[model samples]
Target: MFHGLIPADRYYAYLSFRDIESMPNKENVIIIQTVGAVEQHGPHLPLMTDAAIGLYIVGKTLEQLDHDKSPTIYVLPPQYSGYSVEHTSFCGTISLSASTLTNVLMDIGDSVYRAGFRKLLFFNSHGGQPQVTEIVARDLRKRHSDLMLFSIFAWDLPNIAATLVTPHEFKYGIHAGEIETSLMLVILKEYVKMNLAEKEYPPTLVPDGGLLRIDAGLTYAWMTKDLSQSGVIGDPTEATSDKGEQILASLIASFKKLLLEIDAFNSHV
Candidate 1:
């Protein structure tokens, strides 16, 4: 367990060690941690697009909690490097091995559980993070049966925001597409270059591009080169800040619901 007060930052790192330590040792007190990736988001978006989007959502979630009088949730610092070996095919993408990330998450979970925090919610902003963190969460649960832990891919929350984007774009907007671009437009406008926005509908790596033309859902793996030369899928040219705001709002609301539900674990346990 950590001793003494750990400094807190509102913007960059957010929560600290002391913040979680000082909180009541109840099920309602949860540690919210997240990990993102520093990878290419097409030419229009910056290399840190994943980080910007993930951190912004985390920051907003914490800001909302400050006013709420329900559960006590602490937003720990956001980790930048996630599982992104598939993205290293493109420039500016830094990634750690799956085993490395999984072990790191397990250690963090173990420390948090030992520090008197019973519930730890992992919020991953990268597509590859969910698979990695979920495995770690399972391992933690097996080691400590009383600890309540779960990991979610935050980007998946925006699935309900599909209406905010074009029907065509939404179907193929898997990567640096309209959905991601619109979110970035609101989260970090300065880092977005609308002038460089372009559309690319890459063919699926699977045979016949899989059922219903859903390349990603195929039971196979692929790299950026197999999809697009520019390291992007879907269309970013049509992204708008207004759409970004709408999607972000929905994501925040969804996150709050999950937090409250998870905090109430004691009632059922």
Candidate 2:
């Protein structure tokens, strides 16, 4: 086994480092599941923008962690295509039914469990697939009592977002908003066309904004179109690369902290 951190980011050479041999022996190695949809992100952003951004942030976070000896983290290849039925009406959006999305996560979880990495983190970037990941995480936790499963949204780093964004932008945590656009600017600036970015708020009366309760019978709620008119929730025009960097930095810090806590929890188990 490697005596200490490898000072390297790529764990598996052939694949995207999800293989067992490439996995470091470091306790509670995180198997990051990059979940996003092939849905429209408005005129400025590409359909694969969400998945691409998620993968990049996870990879960058792992690289920084390795450099700091924070913890041994591995980046798993992203699920480029996922459940996105709501946006299917749009030209660029590709979606699978909710059930299909759930199965995909379950299968992926089984493989990760078999791979000897007991700790799994579903780092979800797309809102549409939250339930699927949640279902897999909960059930997997029950079936494999020795394993630890968690799902996190990359944009949940409010502290970092606050610093980069104005008070107005922070208030609206909707999709393809200032935060996401800024992130795209950093991750895939070439793909972004700022001039085309437009704001379109969805009708407030839409039931899609209604609450969800998994146990009570509502499994999934809300679609992209339900929230915005132009398929954009917040202001994308305010996006800046500087904001993207800070947001990413905060995400890495949060990931480091969360992993350490999970590792400590697993140590006793």
Candidate 3:
């Protein structure tokens, strides 16, 4: 039941040990692990917003692929906990320490590598844990030179936020804002509470021209409490299910293309 989002045939956890050992083109098979976080996403969204997005994207992408013609791609179980030290002050936020997360990912990568699978992709949906995944990927690469490991954020891959959202939202909606709320509408509509949606942004000390900002070339350490009273950084009121559909489609298409590329990739070249 947990694998309902993914096609049963392509769900990695459903296979037996022997099935894995005997899988064709083991080196070329891409094992995707969806990385997400359980953290406060304001009052309008569920704590599993990031996790839901990651799972839905991966599932939809795989569903669109032609298994007979496409590279062998299997979806691993979602990593639901991630580094969210910044949001720990808020209730419903469950964060893993940087070192603990690093170790957990390293162990997962090691297990995947040991299973004779040479390709692994850490498809993360949370903003706080990209660096952790990247570090684990590099460390695993060093340990196993032949393994092809990739770490990427779901939104960063396509970079569709700029085109779909307003300039202010694109810059400030890093948490449970317009983009995330819109996406959640598509991925987990029942959990979203549109009535409670509100717009809030962190207090900015300097003008837009100044270097100091929440996210930019120059930034400072900040917690959610320091930013907004509602634990929101963007305008969720701007979210619409129509916008969510568009974002979902774009993300699925981009992820499907990326998987094919990774399957045929030759790192040495």
Give candidate 1 regions above 4 Å deviation. 1-22, 66-68, 204-216
Q: How high is each candidate's TM-score?
A: 0.87, 0.80, 0.96
Q: Ten consecutive residues with minimal summed lDDT in candidate 1? A: 1-10
Q: Could you give candidate 2's per-residue lDDT for residues 6-91 as a string of tens digits?
A: 22344432345444656567336766777877888888888887887777666665656544665556655567788778777678
Q: Native-vs-model 3 lDDT? A: 0.88
| Number of the predicted model whose TM-score against the real structure is largest | 3
Select the stronger candidate by lDDT from 1 and 3: 3
Candidate 3, residue 73: how far the Cα is off, in Å: 0.9
Candidate 2 worst ten-residue window by lDDT: 1-10
Cα RMSD of all models vs. native, in order, equals 4.1, 5.4, 1.3
lDDT of 2: 0.71
Candidate 3 stretches with Cα past 4 Å from truth are none
Model 1 has a clash total of 0
Each candidate: what lDDT? Answer: 0.76, 0.71, 0.88
Ranking by lDDT: 3, 1, 2
